[model samples]
Target: MPLGVGFASPAAGVLAATGALAALRAAGLGAAHSAVEVSVAQAALLTVGQYLAAATADEGAEDEGTEDEERAGPGGPPFTSLDGVRFELETLEADGWQRFWAALGADRRAAARAWRPFQLRYATAVCPLPADLAAATAALPYRHTAALSAECGPTATEVAARPAPESGRAVPWRLTPGGATAGAARPPGPGRGPLDGVTVVEVARRVQGPLAGHVLGLLGARVVRVEPPGGDPLRGVPPMAGPVSARFTALNRHKEVLEADLRSPAGRAAVRGAVAGADVLLHSLAPAKVPALGLDADALTAVRPGLVHVQASGSGAEHGPGLPLGTDYPVQAYSGLAALVTPPGEPVRPSLMTLCDVLGGLVCAQGAVAALEARERTGRAQRVESSLLSAAQLLCRLGGDGSAPSLPVCTDLAELAADPRLAPALERAGCTLVRPPWTFRP
Candidate 1:
């Protein structure tokens, strides 16, 4: 344990925590698998660890240079404290897997087999739990919490969970009554048909972009599906079903469908004219080809300043290559999305059609709504871009990691379909539970 030899630093702490979490998760600890909450904790730990390491190093360095004070730690992230701890995760892996494993109730031999390294550079500290609690916090798996909850029954799990109720009162889930209504209540009336008067100009390609427009149409947008001359390439895509297939119809339904080649001047003009009178523009133009298609933000804005422009791409605007330059599988593999959905190093086996498109569409729609609201307030339209990369990254749920999300957000078809409550919700939105494939095809 010489000077910097075996001393614990913030980065060292993050590595230890991440390693501990990984080991616990691999052991099938249910609590550890709760990605949402655990990631927050890990992020905090990393940030805190980074701060301590920096401060300790700065004070100990007798010949510290002025630049050292200004230079941010390893990850170059600003250190901010929350709940008294400041840290950041600089790297996912580092050396010293043996020590990490030993902390998690495993012998050195066992640790060697299971050990993998991680680095955390927390720059701050918080004093909430005692030393014992702090040490246990790093080693504790989420499953332990879950198991404890089962012991308490009904709502015991929620009660014992950390960030506990402010008053230390444990309220059971069943005991909590529903039906708290706010504002003036109005009498419920008869529901109307789907997409009665909403106007939509769908200049979409591939499954995700157009399918989103289709969903909007199903939910009551008067979707005018405008496609190129060859029709949506998906129509001719392999794995074809009957003349019209499930994939196509599943994505498109209840809309005024039109076929036009946007590549042609006349076609582009027609689209411009359509947009001038449309409420929303649904597009999934390939990023590289957006300008060529005359469908960039400026052009669309010129056509209809008030239009809610929603775009979906293979990769988001942030990334240089928006979509896969080649096939879907290769793109998925390249994005690392396929890996998360499938087994490690295995080919991606996506379920329920183009999952990215589906989720991207949903995200695009949500963004469009926000944009529309913004336009209403400011009397100006905003271009909204939701790329495949962004959509994929969101799916990954990389909380506080400063990394983009990486997967589609969706429930399995079976899970949603089986739930009786979800059916009414879908129906109310003007979405047809069934349809022909031709409807979805561009």
Candidate 2:
């Protein structure tokens, strides 16, 4: 809490690879030049997009710094048990929240009072849960607490230590081909980007799926984002950029928006219309939701040959009910990332930053790009999947399962951009805008 996170360098490293992939695309296409550049400062800023939205967004009018932020307390999570085991707790539903607390003998009314704020922690960056919840956990040993969780509901993974040797060896993503005797991929059109001619229909929400689509869009792919008919609720969460939330703008500014209720027949038809000629179809729908909506991979790829279908999942959809719901925090806990970034001698915690989400997005983009390349080479790119679980494995492997080093403490985006340590990376040395993360010079 007192230091900046060690997220940017690794993310910039991924971007560098992305740039290299761009050059590879250029070379493969026999383009005249292939040059790419990525900036770490920019990558760091990208992580703060949502927070910046919360900060700069109008609350009737922009209120300056609030009271708690000035005081020194990272007042959120990674709660500790009386037995001295530290861990993060996660449960997607309110009923699960109630059950977990009930098993711990928490007051029913208090548990009910705590649920909304607890759920909003990620969005608001602070959770003012009733103190009773902590008191309940503090009274019990971790084993008791964990046993209750397993018996009833909610996931209570112990903050992990460095994983086994095999953790370091897992690939970030898996690419499965459609079939044999494939047609060669069509040449990308002259649209000024390595992926210019590619069209991607994106049906996703939150960071991972949208971020992947954002990366693809940055690479000059035509990205069409499908949202609910009323639009994503996060759009109105404040810190507006012109009309929409700055966080939304940061992730989605480059893509086209199509509002459709995927639960309806008309909505799926609309998405099918968009994907009719598209090269890629990406979604973050729940594992079963996609099939329920009649958009399963087998059906689509069968109908439209050579389509690169990427699913950004929380856990492997195939794993089914064995894993935590694929949100950023729980995945961090389940995947061992909470432990990797936890400071030595401190309780393990999921990062305030969406580390796995960002990395998952990058990995998804990487898979999509690789799939595109495979299609070009083998003429068949089929189903591709990236999960927060996989990202956590790769992150813990990349960062090691050991406790994380201390980082500079900058409370929010404003303070982060102004931190003197980041001066060299800043274009103006103090600008809110970090350098653009990627550059293509032809």
Candidate 3:
């Protein structure tokens, strides 16, 4: 005979304690129940143990930052900037970021028992993290960090590709005492690069649109990144390395950056003038605001017959009343995603890939490239668009389906992160689990 332990509140702790007895009382559950023990101390100890484990994990995470920084060098820290989010490379070592989050979701049974009311706040403030530290936090693979920085930012090779910086230096405009002196306009020279013959005028803000431009620039397109008169709000974003900073230079490089008040008559005219010669025009204007900007697809096409116009929206052009609710983070959660992350029954935090922006940006770029190719063949202009919601759905489907993806899994960030040799030894084989190596943070 065995003692039966019961939790007074009918909570899982009580159920787990008498698990064996209950299984013996039932028909098929005898083996599963035999593992249960009735001990409040045991339950509490398990909680304490995991919390302590999380703390140790945090310390190790911090140490990784210190050790890697010394080796990564002053100039080698990875940098990422998009929309208004900015973090210095070192901000990656933020204290307790992952540990605290993991602790919050540790015990589902206890969490469900400890219910509380929710409150709302009107505003939240975000601070920039140190560059090297942020690099550690973004935990992007070291290889990706190096490639993105070199490929996106201005490099020695890139400087060599262009005329000397001073070659295009501008002369101040001055009026002569009597009138203006007529100066000869410089003649345009040379054939275009693959994207050379193509001129891109990007009228966008935040990450998605700018990211597309960044990709285009990488492929030899001449991108003239235009922001409103105040400049892209992202310019004021933090993680500022110094005066000009890496965040700004990292994304807007390889192209001309100009600011104009799109609302003003002169600003609108300037954009229209630029549009006349642009092969592609990218904008993120809200659907309702599109008409006011003189940048609706119809207006843009009228100016440049074969312009490849690309736009990115939060919910896409499909949803009616449901559109406004489609932000990237929430979209990930709502799109059967929060349910699909590995450790099936366990609550997992969402990823930081900003998947929506990345995929949506890629889709827009794909559309622009396809449209350009089509124009070469058919000479017809078209509009290319994408939304955050759709991008998430596509990535989720591709991640796992009955049919396997052709591409390799870039990282071990999946629910089934298991070593075939180690998995067979576990007591519970049916449960989904994710135990990526601690070193796999990036």
Please identify model 3 stretches exceeding 4 Å from their true place.
1-193, 324-326, 401-442
Tens digit per residue, CA lDDT, model 2, 1-442: 4221357777877777876776576567765336777777667666665565456444422332334323313334567789877667877788878888888898897777666566766655566656677788889999888889887778776665544345633667778888542355444555466787788999998789998998888777899989898888878755565667666766777688889888788998888878777889988888877887767777776556778889898876446443666778877776676766766676667777777788889888878888887777666756788888887777666664333554565566666655688655443211233334677666
Better of 1 and 3 by TM-score: 3
When sorted by lDDT, best at the front, the candidate numbers are 2, 3, 1
For residues 284-395, could you state the per-residue lDDT of candidate 3 as single tens digits? 6777787788987777656766666777676665654322243444454444433333233333323333445545554555556555554544446657666665555554
Ranking by TM-score: 2, 3, 1
- Give me the displacement of residue 176 in model 1, in angstroms: 42
Alpha carbon lDDT of each predicted model: 0.40, 0.71, 0.42
Alpha-carbon shift of residue 246 in model 2 (angstroms): 1.9
- Candidate 3's clash total is 22
Model 1 spans > 4 angstroms off: 1-197, 230-243, 320-328, 344-353, 398-442
TM-score for all models, in order of appearance: 0.45, 0.83, 0.48
